[model samples]
Target: MAEQPQEVDFALAAYREEGVWQVQELAHDVLENLEHVSSALRRFPGDGGAVGMVAYDEDVFLLVRVAGPTVRLLLSDITAADEWDLARDAVEQLGLPYPEEDDDPAPAGDLDILGDLGMHAMDMGVLIDDYDLYPDEMLSDVAGRLGFGPTFDDLVGLTSA
Candidate 1:
């Protein structure tokens, strides 16, 4: 078994500054959980989609972005052999746990059926935590944050009302 990835102290510090105690703890727990669950996910052809740590000068850096069930390390100059080694090492040494994969397709991204503002709020929270987003920006301001422009407001108006 491979060893678990050490927590990112800086990211934890960011959590302390930007989030409450519960939020920080939840983020920590989710990330730790992801580490284990990454195993058993189909790799994207060789080590392409394996969830393993990337290093700079052989020192770990960056929390390598994971998309859906895919995992990719952010290291440079690594060969396919090295990548496979890292992937297997993470699964075996760190004891990564994966959610049981089911053949069923995921549901649509809708919570309107919940038919309550509270349920919408809960769904929003789930979306925010699952992916990185600009916390300080409003939905109307998201495009501006991403360098798209203030036109996002116009787009929203056209789509909704």
Candidate 2:
């Protein structure tokens, strides 16, 4: 069984309603599983549904975009499934096979998850492939691209106060 992380670096829900973006901190419990995260996101009244961003132990990140009955996912590193339950769950949800020990670290699932929101699949791939950036940095970039960078940064303590 894959081990779950003891703590989540951060988990946030970002949504837009009435043409304005609302960013809020998600409870750590919601990071227990992808289902919980999705459920939490559904409670938001975003015009295009809500998005969940979670980073665990500074090692991996998960993105869940819920729009009505449709749920799209993105795992920053497919290899994380070997030791993280959330990553394992994400792999299962994406209908992907488990990664072999030798598999190189790479992103798995919908690269186009945020395409309609302005971050194209190609760009997302490039961002995820950048090893220098931590999960928080990557997520910050996503929020910025989606027009809510500063808000997200502030919420996650990425901004210097």
Candidate 3:
């Protein structure tokens, strides 16, 4: 597994530009919880709503895209259960009772968020169960699946091999 940081690392707000994807690394302090995630969405001055990715540790990562009342979710570890504020806020955002997953890594919401963009459900399923990868790696997969692999790798400070 890649090294994971203890505190929140960094976030990226991604939006499509003329059919091409673009990613921008956000300030580390810009994200702390689901509310901050929502704030970032509201602050985006793009043509469409932007998706937010927050990686807390190797075991915790959150994918959020808010469109009005609906906040789509894709969490890496369901066991975080309030252990991390990011996870806690996600459950709150979805109004779901925490600690009820029965110890599973299955994602929380629509696995096919990027299905329309490029990723298929089966591919997203594989990524969700890949516990060996770190949060950044998982988010990298998400970005890649959504048609922004190289851009995501560059923005996340990862070099293509």
Best by TM-score: 2
The local distance difference test score of model 1 is 0.28
- TM-scores, all candidates, are 0.22, 0.93, 0.82
lDDT of 3 by residue, 28-113 (tens): 55565577677777676544567888777556777787655556877766667546777776766667667765666556666776
lDDT of 1 by residue, 1-161 (tens): 13233422222101111222111111223234336434322322222222222222232222233345644332221221133333333333334332133322111122222222122435533533432333222332222322332343343232323
- Sequence-dependent TM-score of model 1: 0.22
Runs off by more than 4 Å, candidate 2: 1-5
Which lDDT value does model 3 have at 100? Answer: 62
Steric clash pairs (candidate 2): none
Best by lDDT: 2
What is candidate 3's TM-score against the reference? 0.82
Sorted by lDDT (best first), the order is 2, 3, 1
Question: How many pairs of residues in model 1 come into backbone collision?
Answer: 10
